[model samples]
Target: MSTLLSAIRSLIFVIVLIVTVIPWALGVLLLSVFRRGDPIYWACANWLKIAIWSARWICGVRWRIQGMDNLPTAADRRAGVILLSKHQSTWETFAYPALLSHPLAYVFKRELLYVPFFGWAMARMDMIHIDRGRRAEAWTKVLTQGKRLGAQGNWVIMFPEGTRIPRGQVGEYKTGGTRLAIETGLPVVPIAATAARCWPRKSFLLRPGVVDISIGRPIRPEGREPAEMMAEVKAWIEAEMRRLDPDGYGPPPSGVAGSVEGGTASGPAQPDPLQALSQPPSRP
Candidate 1:
């Protein structure tokens, strides 16, 4: 009976995504292209807001956030930043774009670009995609595209660990983000969150709870090579996540304000612009 109930709930969620979310997303995309200023962006943002609310409020799920104060505001305009974040669930993908003032350009696998309305909307939004197998080529593209987008004042969100990691194991951190920061001379802001607890990747039935997101201080790359900087940023993020989840393999990390008995968090430390450039590379 429990299994059947869960399946039924999941089916309903899928129906909503298709019958409602996709159509509305398309309408917003068309609206954004024609409208200017806050109107279009707000419409886009509002659509997402409603989606999030519906998933939680109307669908019987709950949601909360933490360390949002740490997020950069539009005034910051520290353009061309490489925002590295933990990949646990789909929440960050939707929530980040909705909450952040600057449009977020995500680097995702090329395969995801084929997914119906979501992928279509992402294409219109100018999200980046790369062939997963070609490491060096992908890095080059990242550098080129990242600089272009940054100059236009967009934030780049990269999941350094690549795919979503299971609850306990931390995958080997990749070097793309660090490289982008070094090559573009932009800052790296590590964002750690436990969204999977509320919106678990493996399941569609939304769980009612607050998800914690901690934004670490940004690190500016002065003249350091990408390799060394990648290690520094990776270590910092791993440490922060460990701190957030001492057990490293328990319930998801949670925030301070709200608790669901099980939640998790993940980020990195800050470094001065010149400091990172001066450091020697360490072996990963």
Candidate 2:
């Protein structure tokens, strides 16, 4: 698509977001006073569903996912897992809540709680929002809240890279998510998403294309070191990313295994360029 057309589509999607979030946030605030936990979480997630739908309807950004069977069934109340995902764009952040079956509690920076309407609603939800400046206190909060939320059967989703990395680039994966998983005795599921093919990081321009999301099997944290466990997660996600979007990463360096640096795959590409996920659709 042309730059002008892509920008116009993105603008329309943004307007759809602003139009929906205001009223939705207000409703969540009011509902929080009367109800707590699941009700509030689902209310916020419903708005996310609308956001994802709008992205597909307005921007022509669709997604194909796999490995649904790898996750514990929604009926398993005693089972909880920590999700460590490859962060490329805001698309995954919004799409996960709608796509997944269980409730997800994201570990995010505290500053997001101050954003106008969106942040206000997020503050009310049962999530982990930490202060980045205080590393010690922040880990303590994540441990305590992660355990509590896990006990409630809510999945804690953390971006191991800490921040969004550009497409075809790998960021330093942190051990925070693994630490929480080990501390809470929950397995960690790694995810690789190629949202940047259509929506690049730190940019609003979205081209029409399909994003592939591949969820790896959960790795149990039993007797595993946080750093070591995180490395495994990183390896799986980065390798899967290369497989899902080979054109994005080009070819890995000769000696370096799964090294994606210095490669570039930008702009919209052919629709559903890769094969569909082998598993049957668990959820629409």
Candidate 3:
């Protein structure tokens, strides 16, 4: 797609998002007084579904997912898994709730709760938000809320990289997600999404393309250390990313480092101005 056309479509999609989120947020705020839990959660998720639909029809951004069978079936209420995913763009933040079967609680920064209508609506949901400055308090919140959410059949989703990495590059994988899995004794499901192919990190100019999302088999956290388990998760996601989006990875351009051991591509991190706006409201 041409730059001009892509810009136009992205602009239109942004408008759609704003137009939809206003009334939806207001409704969620009103409902919070009377409704709670799954009812309120799905109400917000429904708006996310509409957002993804708008991205498809307006910006021509599409997705193809594999490995639904890898997740626990609806009948398996006793089973719960924490999702550790490759973060490339804002797309997956919106797409996960709409695409996945289970209700997702995102581990996000507490500041997002102040994002006007969107943040206000999110604050009412049963999700985890943390003060990143308070490391101890944050971990405690994650453990407490993670166990509770997991027991309730909601999947806790976190970006192991901590922040969105540029396409074809690997960020330092954090141990928070794996630590939660180990603490909760829940398995971790690794997800590799190529959303950046169309929606590049730090930019809203979405091009026309299919984002391939590959869900790997769940990795058991029993008897596993957080760093070791996170490394394994990182390796699987990075390798799978190469397989799913070969064109995005290869020899790095000038001044960029090449792939390291365990399939991690090293490079300078890009600033995500949209981090505050694009982050899905909740706790991971």
The candidate that wins on TM-score is 2
Candidate 2, residue 76: the lDDT equals 84
Cα displacement (Å) at residue 120, model 1? 1.3
- TM-score of each model, paired residue for residue: 0.75, 0.89, 0.87
Q: How far is each candidate from the true structure, as Cα RMSD in Å?
A: 9.9, 5.9, 7.6
Clashing pairs in 2: none
User: Distance (Å) between predicted and true CA of 196, model 1?
Assistant: 2.4
Alpha-carbon shift of residue 198 in model 3 (angstroms): 0.7
How many clashing pairs per prediction, in order? 8, 0, 5
- lDDT, candidate 1, 98-184, per-residue tens: 556676778988887688766665555556799979977887788788998877777888998888876446777888788788777
**Model 2: lowest-lDDT 10 consecutive positions:** 261-270
Write the candidate numbers in order of decreasing TM-score: 2, 3, 1
lDDT of 1: 0.63
Error of 2 at 149 (Å): 0.7
Tens digits of per-residue lDDT, candidate 3, 1-284, equal: 49999999999999999999999999999999999987888889989988987898899888877766678875665577899999999999999987776778999999999999999999999889999999999999999999999998889999988888999999999999989998998988888899999999999999999898877777787788999878877766777677678799863335442222222334432212211113332422
Ranking by lDDT: 2, 3, 1
In candidate 2, position 39 carries an lDDT of 85
